[model samples]
Target: MTERILKPGSTLGVLGGGQLGMMFTEAARRMGYGVAVWDPDADAPAHRIATHSFIAPFSDVNVRDRFARIADAVTLEWENVPAELCEWLERGCPMRPSGAVLRVIQDRIEQKQFLSSRHLSVPAFSIVESALQLRSAVDRLGLPAVCKTARSGYDGKGQWVLRDASDVKQVEHILRTANAGRRWILEQFVEYVRELSVLVVRGGNGAQCVYPVVENRHERGILRETLVPASIPLDVAETATEISKQVVTALQGVGVFCVELFQTTNGSLLINEIAPRPHNSGHYTLNVCTVSQFEQQVRATCGLPLGETRLLSPAVMVNLIGEEVQAVTSGEGLYALHATAGAVLHLYGKRIMRPGRKMGHVTFTASQVETATETARQFIARIRRSS
Candidate 1:
């Protein structure tokens, strides 16, 4: 296939019209490009911003062709979109990161295998195909292990942690009720010092750029905060950058990739997972980096030059979840954070609200990450008080 560079007026097609798609469309539109999005929801956030919105199922042939017909290149904000649909679009227009990349990344088992094939470090994992396999994997991996669905699980959904032998019954019940007749992976839980993520973008020409490492904090398996230029040893950050580049290179596709890593107490890094799109942790880049991760995604997919990822300041990002959204709507102190200096708020126009659902995020820049984090904490405390 010949490489083609898309000009400013070219149309970009996006799959999955969620907040990520909305942000990607915003970036593309800002750079004089047009965006067409295909998603089932008519009220999706991206629909309000995209140049064209196909409100139909991903498998609908007409909707798929309409997207491909108008797009010079197609990319996705989420990995769970049907791989067959992506492959079909590939025949009509270029698909960034490729359908093959989606197939490998959409499944936890395949992702781990790919990492292992590249000699990358990952936790011990076993695939469970049946009740017998689940029990055996739990017994082998021991207590405090996590049982996760092999596919379609995110933000702690479709996951159960087993801390003791007695938890086995609860795990079995969850498996039967929540994931009946589906494949799962049992992984040995890592007692990590901190969680880190590297956002790397690789272009069609094999050129790549790495964003500064960000340390993440999760509440109940959902990302809550991210601190850029993670307060780790310089050598450790360098190592993570190199590892993230290797993962993107191995993917053999063009687009932004988010590699989540676990920093163990022994100071070693292990691959936790990979997302082939602009990630939640990379949200700080929109405020503190020379170029946002969403813009980098558009640049890489369109065969444009990868943007600078130099951090403009020490930054912290706080996720405004559904619970916080409720508080803010009720005239709680959560809305008072809008007055915070050096803070930038981005609210996704999502109507539905539920516990743990991501509604938006706020980023704060400061001379030091500690100061930025403290300011974010104050806002979080205010929101918590209302809850």
Candidate 2:
């Protein structure tokens, strides 16, 4: 495809005004591009940062038309945007990553099928459209498997892990309550030694760049921290890089693709899931890389040259969830963290907090990866303590 660059001073349309959209707006603005954001929430983070914000749902045709008419090119910050809405936008203006990618990713079964079709390794999974299928899947996958809704699951929601014999009834009950009459997938839980993610950016011209593999830690199925230059064998990291490139290429993906992987104890890697936007794992790049994932997303989607992803320092990123926010504000921990020499704090400016909702993150760089990891973990522990 010929490159049709959306130059600086051009308006870039962003769908979904979450934190990722907020950061993407900041990046585009810094690069001299104007941004227009569309989200249902009036007070969304990106709405405050964007040059123009439409507080209308993606399904609103008027808003979609206005957004397309204004933006030189459109890019989405989240995948849950209706595929039909994306297709409608494509008729008037360019949409990066394309609606095709969203169609596959918005549903778990489709995503897993896409991966399998591309010869990539994913956990053993079966689509469950009925109770009989669920029972069959459970019997085949055995105990300790997970049942997840096929669509709209994020941050550990819309999923249940079955650990033992008695959990089968609980799974049936939960599925009946929450996912009745909807598609779902039953997957055998993978026992992995490391949970890793790779951020890959692909330009319109098919040029690509990859960030260092990130090691992620999750508590209650939400990301808590990320350690850059994850301590893994050189070969393992190389494998992840190759697999990420393959996934992006197969999707014909443009913009940042966050590919999550599972590294087993025996050193084999399996594709866990994919997020086609700037991800929480890549947040550390903002402080430690030559160019951040957000900046790269702007470049990749706007037809600019992809930037260098070289790491400038070993860093650790700790997420600030709602509970942590309360702990920090109620104690001296926030002040102490602010005073820390190497720590960089980033708050999302969220007005309300839920138990596991991501409110912000802190990145700290150290001479060594171990030091960075320990410092980030310790700081989080300190901040989570009460006064």
Candidate 3:
């Protein structure tokens, strides 16, 4: 049976309207598709540009019906958007990644278990439903482990690093005071050589395209920068790409998915976590790739042929978090940023700024990876000093 293709001018529905959704909307519009953005937050950046905007809660049946009626297909910007909502939306329009996939990936424990059950390499982990269970899990995993909420946490929130007994006690108290039945996962802390990520786009027909593995650096659990064509051996990059493709294929996922991996000192790769949508690490794709990840998301969601993933140039992507955006908004910092060659700036158009919030990003592209890396490093350092 031939799959239906949503031709250009078709309205594509997107759940969650953050920066990723905003970028997706932009891409879809550029490709001659109209986007319907459904996010409860009216201030969501995507809503500002969407052809149709729904500010109602996901549970509202009226909004759901209307959105389903207008959209030819649907995709998500964030994993945390209720899986039930995706299931409901699936009845009227195709969900790029079915709700079942979202249910498994949205929870930390389930995601890890699913990958491990599939014979994939993942960090050692144990589930914790209570303080006592947490203690036991820590004992089994040993000290210097990490504990994170099983659901609904990102950008370093709802996570704790247990370097000692005191840190464990602090987390235990927080768990004890929390509502009942809350679950968390304790993972063995890995001594990794570097963090890496790859973006895979799978069409509804099961055709897949894998992007180059990129190196990522995080500060306080937030992604700070990404280096394209990760500074790793060819074999390691191939292995990482293979593992990422294996993961999305196992889940039967359609759309753009980013697989984060840990390259251990032993030269083995361990699955860190997966993002159902385009990832921050892949932001470099916009500047250097033949087809940006956002465009791939649009094509995959509409059942169109997946775009080429060829890299046009070596690049580096640096995120502007919170007040760091002020550096590029005006003054000598702004002039300096614009003065630099091969630097592209992208601001998320977020009106409010708070600590730890992602505000914008800068992608530096150059003929050589070393040039891009150095330019990005100097830019980052200048922003930090100004901030």
Candidate 4:
């Protein structure tokens, strides 16, 4: 089949201005494509580097039209860019991954139901409104469950883990956690040994590509590290890849799609979440693989074939949140991070250093995942020292 053109010098419009968008802009720039992004934050990471930035609400049709006029095509850094805005813009220009896919993923309830409809196994979950409904859901799903806001939750924010009925009393606090115009979703906790992620890139012509599985680690509910070529059995790893493909076909999605799953002791995999962008888990690909997720995102959105997903060596990626960076109090602490072997530090140009805000990341590759992991861990001590 003949392919469409996504030649160099093409201008791409991105919808959000977070780090993912920043990285995407960097990749596009490297490939000789001009990038433009629309975000409200003047200091947003992506906006800092974009060739053109419209500092306005994504919901504004005029901004969308302006982006359409300036850019050859449209894409987004994250999934929550109000598909309505994309839909409104699509009438003016092409937007990748389709509004259909975005609509299902924008809401957690719809995302979970879409997975279930495709015969994918996800954690036991219930959607609740009132506190009484939450208590009833907990009663059915059991204690020790997690309640996550159905929309606008990410980076371990907007979640509550309840050990028992007493947790129901905190519903008001949970409700207030999300910005207005969102609701909470309750999910039964799964006893899993590890969390894994797979990223798939589908071209405009329906051509597809896949990346290797990555195991993720979390601290205090926030993602802390990701290890490439996960230690799971080969069969399990392949299974994860297959499950990810299932999600891709189910969503009828094009461009990079991320599937987060939990692997149980009984050799089962269950869906955890989905992200239709350059994901945090795929950060290791920047150095470990021949093609990084950011590159793949642009390639797929531009209707090009996917690239290699091979790993040259074991790799680990560490997230540097604002809270963690602020805790680094001295020059010595900052120097330690720069000194780590094989470390590639990517700092988002976000001006705010608020607690729990994702600031940047460090990645390293080695022949040994465990040793690489330990080396990455040593930075925590330095962080503590600086704090």
Candidate 5:
């Protein structure tokens, strides 16, 4: 393939209108690329600064055509966008890290197949399309497994973990109720040491860029904090980097690719899941890396040579889930942190916050790991109290 680029001042189309889209738009604008975004919500953050906004659902043909006509190239913020919709746009304009990437990622069964095809190590999993299939999967995978939907599931949604023998009946019941007996995957659970992620960017020519491995902390399946330069064995990190590259290659991904991984108790690396765009783990890059994940994503998707993904310093990040969201009042525990120097706070101008909703985040660096971890913990404590 020849080197291709979407020059500055070119318009980039973005799908979805959440913070990720907002950040992607901001990155493109900073690089002199005009951004056109499509989202059903008129007030989406990306719309605030986009060159143009096409207000419609993800499946709206008019919105897709408008994006194709306006943007030099197009990409999505999330992976759950319907494959058929993405395929429809491919006839007109580029929608990348490849709509095929989205198609595989949106379904766990396809994702597992993709990974297995690459010879990447993954937990034992079986697809369940019927009650008998579910029973067979249970028999094979055994007790203490997870049943997850093949599509449109995130933040721990559309998933159930089975630990007890009786939980098998409960999983079948839940799947029947939820999907009307649609297909799902039953995966063996891992008693892992920790979760980690790597964000890789591959340009049109396969020029790959990688961010520092991030150690992620999760609460109720949502991210809590991400610490860069994750304290792990050097080999563990290297293996993760290698696996990420292989995954990127397998997908023919042409933008940001986030590889969620698990460090097993026995020190082996196993893939957890994948995201075909800028990820929450890479959020720490905004303050700690030379090129933020947002910028790297735009550059990669636009066919520009991706910048270095080097780290500036050891960093810690804490997510703020504040209350008083509806009232716009400061919710719990802001004062608990009272962070001194080098602290960066980013609040998403959300009007209201209920429990578990991400309100904002704080990121900063520390010379010592203990200090950084303590600071991040306190900052989260502050937000916890407010909520």
Candidate 6:
């Protein structure tokens, strides 16, 4: 079947209204497409700029029906959005990535199993339905393993690292007191050399474009910075790229996807996780790439031709977490950041800020990677001192 191409002026529906959705909405609007954002939070950033907005729970059948009636094509900014909702939307129009894809990627156990079954390299993991299962899995995977909820966790939430017997006992007790039938995953810990990620955009026609591999640094499991063109051997980069493309193609996914990987001490790569939408690490594309991940998402969703993934410059993307946003939004810090050459600041426009919440990001671009890296380091240090 020929894919239906949604032309400009047609309304595009996005399932979540966070920063990713807001950016996708901006990109669609720039390309002459109207955007309808559906997020339960009325204060979600995308809701403010959306041409149409649906502020209702995903379980609300009435809102789902109304959204299905108006949207020409549908995509999502968050994987946690109910797969059933995507399945319902699919009956009306194209749902990029589809509900089936979500069901696989949203659950840690299922995602690991799918990748492992495909012979793709992934961390050793076992499913946990109860504390007893957790202990059994730990006996196999051993200490220092990580335990995470099978669903609905991001940016360090719903996770624990069991480094010793005490940690294991505490986590087991936490699990024991939790709701019945809830699932978790125990993964063998990887002492990786560096964290790396690649963004892949696949179209309905099976054509794909991959952005440059990037190195990521995390602070307490939250992404602190991303360095474009990860400083790895050419062979390693090629392998990472190949693995990411293979994963997305195997899923039959038709949207922007981010594959997180761990480069172990042995120089082999292990799949960490996958995100089915534009990722924080790819934010550098906003300033350095010919087409940002958000724009690629719009194109893939609308069946439009995918854009070029050319890198315009080396860049460092630093996320503004929680109170860090205050340092850059006003006063001398804001002025200093604005004055820095090749630096671009993007604020998410979220109303409330709390610890660990992602508020915005800054992208620093330069002709040389070292220059961008040094400038970003200096800026980060300055902010830390102020905070």
Best by lDDT: 6
- Candidate 4 TM-score, C-alpha based: 0.94
Expressed as tens digits, the lDDT of each residue in 1-387 for candidate 2 is 778888899999999898999999999999999999999998789999899989987778787777888988889888998888887787887888789888998999999999999899999998988766778898898878988989998889988888986776777766666644699999989899999999999998989999999899998889989998999989999999999999999999888999999998777899989998899999998999999999998988788889999899999998888778665554477687777768898888888777888988889998899888888878877775651
* Candidate 5 structure quality by residue, lDDT tens digits, 198-247: 99898878778788888999888788888888899898899999999999
**Could you tell me the lDDT of residue 176 within candidate 4?**
49
Clashes in model 1: which pairs? none
List pairs with backbone clashes in candidate 5.
Answer: 325-351, 325-352, 325-353, 326-352, 331-386, 332-385, 332-386, 333-382, 333-386
Q: After superposition, which runs of candidate 4 have C-alpha atoms over 4 Å from their true positions?
A: 1-3, 172-182, 326-330
**Which residue runs does candidate 3 get wrong by more than 4 Å?**
none
Point out the higher-scoring one by lDDT: 2 or 3: 3
Question: What's every prediction's RMSD, in angstroms?
Answer: 1.6, 1.4, 0.8, 2.1, 2.1, 0.7
Clashes in model 4: which pairs? 329-386
Estimate TM-scores for all models: 0.96, 0.97, 0.99, 0.94, 0.94, 0.99
Shift of residue 352 alpha carbon in model 6, Å: 0.4
lDDT tens readout by residue for model 6, 1-387: 567899999999999999999999999999999999999999999999999999999999999888998999999999999998898889889998799999999999999999999999998899999999999999999988999999999999999999999999999999999998799999999999999999999999999999999999999989999999899999999999999999999999999999999999999999999999999999998889999999999999999889999999999999999999999988999999999999999999999999999999999999999999999999999888777
lDDT of each: 0.89, 0.88, 0.94, 0.82, 0.81, 0.95
Q: Count the backbone clashes (under 3 Å) in each candidate.
A: 0, 0, 0, 1, 9, 0
lDDT of 1 by residue, 112-224 (tens): 99999999999999998776778999878887898898999799988888888777777776666654668989999999999999999988889889999999999998999
True-structure RMSD for candidate 6: 0.7
lDDT of 3 by residue, 1-387 (tens): 557899998999999899999999999999999999999999999999999999999889999989999999999999998899899889888998889999999999999999999999999999999998989999899989999999999989999999999999999999999898899999999999999999999988889999999999999999999999899999999999999999999999989999999999999999999999999999888889889999999998888888999999999999999999999989999899999999999999999999999999999999999999999999989988989
User: How well does model 2 score by local distance difference test?
Assistant: 0.88
Ten residues in a row with the worst lDDT in model 2?
325-334
Candidate 6 lDDT (Cα, whole model)? 0.95
Segments in model 1 whose C-alpha atoms lie over 4 Å from true places: 177-181, 326-335
